[model samples]
Target: MNWQPAKKQNDYVQTRNKNFSPPTVNQVLQNAQKMIGPISESPRLDAQVLLAKIMKNSRTWLVAHPKSRLGAQEDVQYRRLVARRAHGEPLPYILGTWEFFGRRFQINPSVLIPRAETEHLVEEALGLLRNNRSVLKVLEVGTGSGCIAVSLLLEMRSLGVVATDISLQALRTAAQNIVNHAIGDRIDLVQTDLFSGIRGQFDLVCANLPYIPRKVLNNLQVGRWEPRLALDGGEDGFIYLRRFIAEVAKVLAPGGSVVLEIGEGQDEEVRSMIRLGFPRAPVRISKDLAGYNRVVVFET
Candidate 1:
């Protein structure tokens, strides 16, 4: 349980291999199976990933060489990662990078961590872009970690994107992802809240703004580690959604669409507000894998 700076990477890896405690692969698998559905649903897979990361090897390589002894440094690193995971730290934060939409994205504490639900937004957006193959102007509000924006750019490399965030720190992190992904020239990162500093009309506007009510945020599991600005959505949690609906009409191109990631139980209200604000804007609700209404699309 004691944390220490890694003396040497390989030394840590070796220690993890020798001190894993589980007697056999089956034992390790059993322990992982038991851990799943409690803290993390993918405990078995997470174990392999954490072990592979510590071993500085691919997941396939780790699977192929599970019994291969780790060097001293690799063992220590594996134990450190496991200990962190045993607490509540996310695996992506520990690995420092996560795969999103078939591409690698660097993640840090500066921005809200990306989630699977948000990927639904990406899927819907891509569907929209595919339907309209023309070069499109896209804007992503609250582009934390640039996960959504970067993924869009990577998915639709030919389009131009403008990604905005209220936090300079988040923008910095997002900018890094842009550059790292080699899409620096294709997308722009602006430091602004919503579309305050943005100009012109975009064919599509995407926002995954904070939608957690101030009251509920404190009790949410995500509130423990994520930035409050990314979760606290005022008293009712629809403050930002309402405001976005009000202002988006002015900035949206004729026949353009707006994609929003909504919070649980707020989809109906959000869709209603979007309709009331932009009566001409066609509003539709989309659900996630869990069958929750998680995305709202507004066509102007």
Candidate 2:
């Protein structure tokens, strides 16, 4: 797999620089931008955010107080984190928190970092279920950090969610997020591969399962940094998704829906599979901010 390549870590790590003194916010950001430019798409923003995180201040604060110097310990910590980022570690994993659907979620390498594209899946679910008068029951196939399930519960007051993940470590990570959002009572975190131990009908099913095809995953930095179990979707990237489609009819209530975040060009393939599972269910497609074919939906 192609891990994000960076200039050597030793170049960035001074490894904590015991003799190094604190530097002004602007100075440190300038240095970090050069250090992180290789692996990050947004070097300056990444530098600012990481430094702001270390400083316990906002990026705007950093801008306004560009001359403000970091403490000795904070400087060391900032460089240490910069080294980790320079080595291809994702920013969210380094920071331990990521914003999804306007809320911050705790994240680790154990779980897939929540992506903005998946918010379309969440919105698709809410758009279909929000007006329903009854309490909507939701089944999230791979809960990851529980961001999707948690986002749903927060937006709609009448949702009861049952979220499952194959990895116990991933589930533990999701559990922390569930607690962080104070939605534990409303959601059940289960450790199961797909729908293995799951039962009962649901009003809606939403998932951002691993759909990165093995070949594509092989060349992607995400596959290197994110959990393999949460990124690999077998040879064609449809292993888990196909399995979910096959079993969905058995668990979905009449008129219920399935919302999924699919790969950029997998819309037709996913639609074809959904056709086999729910021949008559109407399918809807929604694009992400980048206009990629992203969230796909089908209703039973």
Per lDDT, the best of the predicted structures is 2
Which one is best on TM-score?
2
Cα lDDT tens digits, model 2, 187-238, are 9988987888788999898888898899999999888889999999999999
Q: Which stretches of candidate 1 lie over 4 Å from their true place?
A: 1-38
Q: Looking at candidate 1, what is the lDDT of residue 187?
A: 87
What is the clash count for each candidate, in the order shown?
Answer: 21, 0
lDDT of 1 by residue, 1-300 (tens): 223334455544534565554233333434444444267868878778877666567778766765666554454556566666656677788778877777888888778888889999999988888889788999999998999998988888678999998999889888888889888888888888777868989999999999899998888767876789888999999888888988887778989988999998997788678768777766778899999999988677
TM-score list, all predictions:
0.85, 0.92
Q: How far does residue 229 in candidate 2 sit from its true spot (Å)?
A: 0.6
